[model samples]
Target: MNLGELEKAALQYFWSHEEADAKQVHAYFETKRGGSLNTIQSTLDRLFKKGLLKREKQGYAYVYRQAMSKDAFIGELVADVTKDFFKPTENALHAAFTSMSSSLSDDELSELETLIEQQRNNARSE
Candidate 1:
């Protein structure tokens, strides 16, 4: 499922905060970019339609929670990007790693190396 920028932002907000009401989401976005409550509500409704969000009636307000975990959602998004833009090629994966590796800390790089070694070992075993 393709998510618009506003829907992605709303989902991220709910993911980070656990749960949020429309008013709170509206205020959050308004601070970042001036938008009416209707806009936020519409985007949230769209997210609901996309099955990315679940809403519960809390008193007079609706509280929203993410339907998918952050990691799962990110994995799905990455898979979609790889499929559509990268065609699942080794060059695409290498480019992504190269771009991201520059930002990795020493510990992160060590962990990545370990992960690569483990994967290599697994491939050999298979």
Candidate 2:
């Protein structure tokens, strides 16, 4: 899936903030990056349509929140890319992690290892 610059920015905004209406989101971006409120509303609507955001109509306007966490979104993107080239076998997954680990710092690798251990434990319990 391709994301435009504004779309990516909107996703990041939703990830950071719990929920926001179009005006609130537009105000947040105004000082940092200038954009019209209509543009921000369009971006939010696009994200909602893409299923990256959840929205509820609150009286006069809709308030939006992220449909998934940032990590979940990244994981989905990784899975999407990996599925195109590999069948998702254990060896393929291991190779992918090993290659990706080359750029990670020691602390990040440790955190990754912890997450993997948690997943392993969860799988065992299930």
Candidate 3:
């Protein structure tokens, strides 16, 4: 899904904080980003409509939080971007991961390897 700058910033805020009303979000962004409360409210509404945020009415205002974790959002974005061009295959996926991992440090690469091994073990059990 496409996201505006404010939308992305608002999502970041939700990821870091538990939940917030529009005014609180505006307060957080007022100095750093300099947008009005209406803008913040609209951004939150848009995010809620897009299913990126969960909101429920609290008194007269809505309190919002992220619908998914940051990693899940990123995974969806990666899948969305790659879906059109690639007919995913094991080798293709491996190649893509290897290419992406090229910039990783040794420790990060080892962590990735451990995760892969854990996935393999899980799959075998399943």
- Per lDDT, the best of the predicted structures is 2
Estimate, for each residue in 27-126, the C-alpha lDDT of model 3 and write its tens digit.
9999997988999999999999999999999999999999999989997887777676677554455556778999999999999999989989999999
Every candidate's lDDT: 0.85, 0.92, 0.91
List model 1 lDDT by residue over 47-84, tens digit each: 88888999999998788889999878886776667666
On TM-score, who's better, 1 or 3?
Answer: 3
Compute the lDDT of residue 31 as modeled in candidate 2: 99
Task: Score residue 20 of candidate 3 by CA lDDT.
Answer: 93
Writing each residue's lDDT as its tens digit, candidate 2 over 65-98 gives 9999999999889877777787656456666788
Superposed on all Cα atoms, the candidates' RMSDs to the truth, in angstroms, are 4.8, 2.0, 2.2
Candidate 3 lDDT score relative to the true structure: 0.91
Q: Pick by TM-score: which candidate is best? A: 2
Instruction: Pick out the ten consecutive residues of candidate 3 with the lowest summed lDDT.
Output: 87-96
- Residue 76, candidate 3: how far off, in angstroms? 0.6
Clashing pairs in 2: none
Off by over 4 Å in 1: 83-106, 112-126
